[model samples]
Target chain A: MLPIATIVFREFLEIALIISLVMAATQGLQGRIKIIMLGLGIGFLGAAIIAFFTDTLAASVEGTGQDIFNAGVLFVAVGFLSWTVIWMKHHAKHLSQRIHKVGSEIVAGETSIWVLVTIVALASLREGAEIVLFTYGMMASGQVTWSDVFTGASLGAVGGTVVGVLLYLGLLRAARRHLFAVTSWLLVLLTAGMAAHGASYLIAAGVLPDLVPQMWNTSHLISGESLMGEILGVLIGYTPHPSGMEVLFYVTVVVLIALLMYRPWHSKAVVAQK
Target chain B: MRFSFPMLSLSLLLGMMTLAPMAGAEEPTYTLEIKDHTFSPETLTVPADTPWTLIIKNHDKTPEEFESTELSREKIIPGGGQVRIKMGALKTGTYPFMGEFNPDKAKGQVIVK
Candidate 1:
């Protein structure tokens, strides 16, 4: 794949996966699509603003401004996404029982669709700003023509949307009976992955310690920047090489959410009743 | 007794925060200049196997991403400003990087020897 296409495609795919997960999870909910679209609109606008002053933004925070801002976006998304899972458990038919089976009480999904909206916006903003910054960079360098960047970006966006469509359809059809199961689990993994990636950017910025620099190098096998690696990177935050802190963030997110949802003591009560 | 998860995790956080990077072990900081959409000293040589800091000063009034896949690092430097990029130790080789905003003019490389 050409570098331009690969770069654009990778970023587009990251946002696509997040959007698709939310779409599938909130399936059958009223007006969720409109909310998500509104989110995309706001996110794109925010991205344009950010892109316009990327230089100013990057120069802030003792020169780690972009990293700090991006990290904040990631963390906010993490918080809201976790809330989504808990909210769904209380609001959805299957999730309530599922939570009960695990000895946890569901919160009223009354948390407003705005939580999901914020997540969608933040996720879209991160990638959208990246696209703007990258394209502008290439444009200024004059190494690539404007048409080239535009075409590459269009193709990449389409490609990402195609995969997203497939995911949503597959969930709606093949997994109709288990939509709750699949989507809820997918949300958990996706959230954890986001946490891990956020930690990595912080590590790169020297804001976080590198407990262990390289857990292993799979770059020789499948580089993280490769197309497959990029897809996996989006779907599960997979990396060819991960630092110790990234692993810690990933595992902690997964375990923490699981424990919150599982409520072991309540499960024991459920088991006794059964 | 069941461990109070909140208390335990809080303690862990405090412990790690205490072990922050020491004031010493400072590496040499290198400088790169971006003027009129171009980088000065297009070829910078640094010692191999030594981590260093790069303070990129952009003289132009436009933003550029200081990106190098080879060095596995990418950061943006705004116009008429500066940004610091910390590159880990490198093996002896030439790693090319460029201004993502002005790829045509802002070209440069880090020569590790």
Candidate 2:
């Protein structure tokens, strides 16, 4: 049950991002739909391949080994994705203008529309790939139902599409400015939590000894595997009591990355105006 | 502090190989006796990368399941019978085997030297 909830939450976030991007390309950019769909199909294929491999590899390494690998992957991915999100928010206006200029310049060249189509398609595909990896990570943890993940993903995509369409139609203009900001911060939190989760798994595998055994006892309330913890676990990488290094990994990574992003584009109006 | 990369790997590899008694290329045959629901000589030493057969003679009255998640293999043997587990030149590590029915009493460790 807890696993189901976890799947739903992760899928919701992933689908929301995908829908937002698709809508942004179609309505916002006044781009061709056929090209975008083509890109999505390609992305789906790539995602399927990645999902298959990640599943097989994860199965080969369970308990301790599985946990360490998951944590490492999550750390790197979160770092990369967070960086990309921050970059996009800071430069979206400039990027859009640049893309429009490039599009117009190459409009006279051989199939400029195809280039734009390819660009949007590739971006969407990248997002799809991330979704596959993230979903696999959640499943490998043995905490969620496949049904919950699919259902959540469907709902999230639908909701995102609606919001994206609204944004494209100029119905939800104000929301766009802060959307990336909110998502970026949430990602920071999630990644930090993942670090701790990874540490715990390593401890379980005996790869790393419990330097500080029982960071804090939560058996009285909700054990680590409880439904509540599972939900929190997926949402923010929650741990009942974390070790010193685990806490350090969580706090330092999230806070440091957030700090790096906050300084340059902290002002909503400034970024939105650009 | 200034150890060359290849040299470092060689040293570690050599150390591990020496530490693991069953890690030798030469295959060795041994008998594991299970009497009174306990594995005799709980620790079996063998060289790594050496193919070996684990002959389990269960002289107990009940059944026992020899399970190893790491090895991805499990075999069940009934009372008054013997079973064979083929360790095909196993990797250099301790492969833990347990009896599903009597886990506490039916515990044993396979050490790859």
Candidate 3:
């Protein structure tokens, strides 16, 4: 039961961190909770379906299908996150003002709402699928009883969510004026991290070159399995030993998102200079 | 600074094209099998400073996640299934791996020399 809880907690931590960041970033958006809940529902359904087809997925594309599928999911999530950060940058001020005037019920256009939903769904689906597969395998092997699985899973979920809640609260405590800026930058890092992760999967699938496969190794200093490593990995895409291609993907996404969000051509200073 | 969207897109495309995989010398291959949650051979040795392919065949009745923090690789091997993992060149050291589902029982290492 302890081991099961540990594994589940590790998986859930990633999902929890992502959801909390999105939740904090979208604070005061009307019906955001319902939209996120819907995303969770969709993700849960998807996880079960993916687990059921794990064998087929593993066998496809000459045993690289799982890698390709994972890469696809991560890349899609990166896309949604990039869009959200940029969109929020444009409308955050107006949305916050409306929230204050309307007393906390501000609808941020349907398109943005759906974008958040998709982002939440993808995050959950990626982590949730692994949990489903692990538990299913444990059950099939008769190594653990049903009650133990339930207890461990519940404990793990609660433990992981508590950390995420703490993070959300910390974000809420930030100065209101700077909260959007902080969350937006965090999302940018998150997006870049996802892109780097996706690139690693493609490299694993032999679809992309690793470039310089071990640019550096810091595993002795910080093992990837450590709690700190897991949190940092989710927050900033920290890898103890990252390939050159992974670094390239990370930098590219960060620069691209920053360019899109700031849009220097539209800056007041640039326009004035022109 | 005027950065045209077209130029940005073009640069991005060019950058990605540069990442296209190059045909390299075939990597050495090693096989590891799992039965009853334990790895066969328990330790695999390979030449240092050369990338390799690891073929893991899980002959058990349950899925196992082949994980190695040292190698920075994680993948699931379904019951009675096999997977090919592309390992990076190593620097003459031991990289331990395990079946994450049964870490205590299923463990192995790759010795790069």
In model 2, which runs have C-alpha deviations exceeding 4 angstroms? A1-64, A92-177, A217-229, A262-274, B1-113
Tell me how candidate 1 scores on lDDT: 0.73
| Most accurate candidate by lDDT | 3
- TM, every model: 0.76, 0.40, 0.91
Can you give the lDDT of residue A16 in candidate 1?
Answer: 82
Poorest stretch of ten by lDDT in candidate 3 chain A: A265-274
Top-scoring candidate (DockQ): 3
Compose the digit string of candidate 2's lDDT tens values, residues B86-109: 445455777677765455677888
lDDT tens digits by residue: candidate 2, A1-274: 3433343344443433433433343222334465557656765786566444533333332212233443344443444434444454455565466666676332222243444344344434434544555455445544457886777566656654554455344523554566545545555675567556555444433344345543554534754445566445544666665655567667876776666666555577665765
Which of 1 and 3 is the better model by TM-score?
3
What are the per-residue Cα lDDT tens digits for candidate 3 across B1-113?
Answer: 12243244335434543443332337788999999999998999999988787888999989999988788788999999998777777789898999999989999998899
Q: Which docking band does candidate 1 fall into?
A: acceptable
DockQ rank order: 3, 1, 2
On lDDT, who's better, 2 or 3?
3
DockQ, every prediction: 0.26, 0.03, 0.35
Scored against the native two-chain complex, candidate 1 gets a DockQ of 0.26
By lDDT, the candidates rank as: 3, 1, 2
Q: Give the fraction of reference interface contacts each candidate recovers.
A: 0.25, 0.00, 0.38
